[model samples]
Target chain A: MKFGIMVNEGPYTHQASDSAYNFVAAALEKGHEIYRIFFYHDGVNNGTRLTTPPQDDRNIVNRWSALAEKHEIDLVICVAAAQRRGIADADESKRNGKDADNIAPGFRISGLGQLLEASIQADRMVVFGD
Target chain B: MEEAGETKKIMYVNRKAPYGTIYALEALEVVLIGAAFEQDVYMMFLDDGVFQLKKEQDTKALGVKNFSPTYRALEMYDVEKIYVEKESMEVRGLTADDLIIPVEVKSNEEVTKMMTEMDVLLNF
Candidate 1:
């Protein structure tokens, strides 16, 4: 089945990101296709490349980026939510006159329409958040 | 990926109160954006979410946008299938007249049955 996943909370502060990662990994292992993974609300924080965890801890942002790279999944961070939380791509950074863009690799900034489109395209839509 | 112009039954489940957190407003934003796709959309206000439709909500003191009026504008966006859980409202001491817009007051069982018919359920 094609799945659309939504993450609505930030990493470390919540277990939502970890749970979603495990679910997606298991689903992919079972051969289910991922339509898209949309990051909204505080979940957009997962797309920032600036995160640095303890040496022993799991690096949440890199985990998502690596998974997307291996599976060729579209990892979309909601543009409105990302901007509000200061998670920007290089283009968005230039447009807003910011000095840097922190969006991690394998994630792209987009509109909420992508979420709606994913809902229509995917057979199932799963949301993980508080 | 699905082609354009194909419609699906989508439901937005709201369980949080407005102003206190961003869930209610976030759900509203998705509903408005989804309306443009011409899909069959439904909105359900249950638990503390029913407070979102309350009449005379003054957010000036809280310094937040009073979005209660936006409920009335939903009809213009062709999002008319709105439901309010009866038990939630009764327990909260609210009635249909207390809301800013018209909504079908449904029992939890009835709403559950409706939810099963939906293709997508987006909870906020």
Candidate 2:
């Protein structure tokens, strides 16, 4: 079965992104296809390349990038939400006249239409948030 | 991308107030975009979410954008299946007349039934 996922909270501050990653990894292990993982609200924070945690702690952003790279998952951050939270890609940064882009690899910024389309195309849509 | 003539019953469940957190406003953004897909979309307001539709909202004092006007424009976007929980309003001491738009005031049980009837359920 194909699964659509939405993560609605940022890392560290909430367990939502962590839980979503675990769920996606488990689903992949079970041989289920992940259609897309959409980042909305503070969840867009998970797609930034600027996060640097302690040496002992797990790197949440890099973990997602690796997972998406290995499985070729479509990691989408809602453009509106990302803009509001300052998570910008190269194109977004250029368009908005920002100094630099911060979007992590294996993730792309897009519109809410992507989320709606994922819900329609995927077998099930799962949301992880507060 | 969606196939031609393919549609899903998408429901946006709003259970938070408009301000304080960004869920309600962001949830509204999703609903507005979902309208373009030509799907069977429904917006259900319960708990403090029902407060999102109260009349005469003034966010000028709060220094935030007043988005209450968008609720009235929902019908223009062809999203008219609006519902408010009966118990949520009764306990909050609000009536249908107090809301800015017309909605189907359904009981909790009926709301649950309607939710089960949907193909996709999104909560905020």
Per-residue lDDT over B30-121 for candidate 2, one digit per residue giving the tens place of the 0 to 100 score? 98888888899999999999999999999988899889889999999999999999999999999999999999999999999999999899
lDDT of 2 by residue, A41-102 (tens): 99999998899999899999999999999999999999999999999999999999999999
RMSD of each: 1.5, 1.1
Q: Please write out the lDDT profile of model 1 over residues A1-130, one tens digit for every residue.
A: 9999999999999999999999999999999999999999899999999999998999999999999999999999999888888999999999999999999999999999999999999999999998
* Model 2 interface CAPRI class: medium
Candidate 1: which stretches are off by over 4 Å? B1-3
Interface RMSD of each: 2.0, 1.5
Superposed model 2: Cα runs more than 4 Å off: B1-5
Candidate 2 residue A39 Cα shift, in angstroms, is 0.5
Worst 10 residues of 1 chain B by lDDT: B1-10
Q: Return the clash pairs for model 1, or none.
A: none
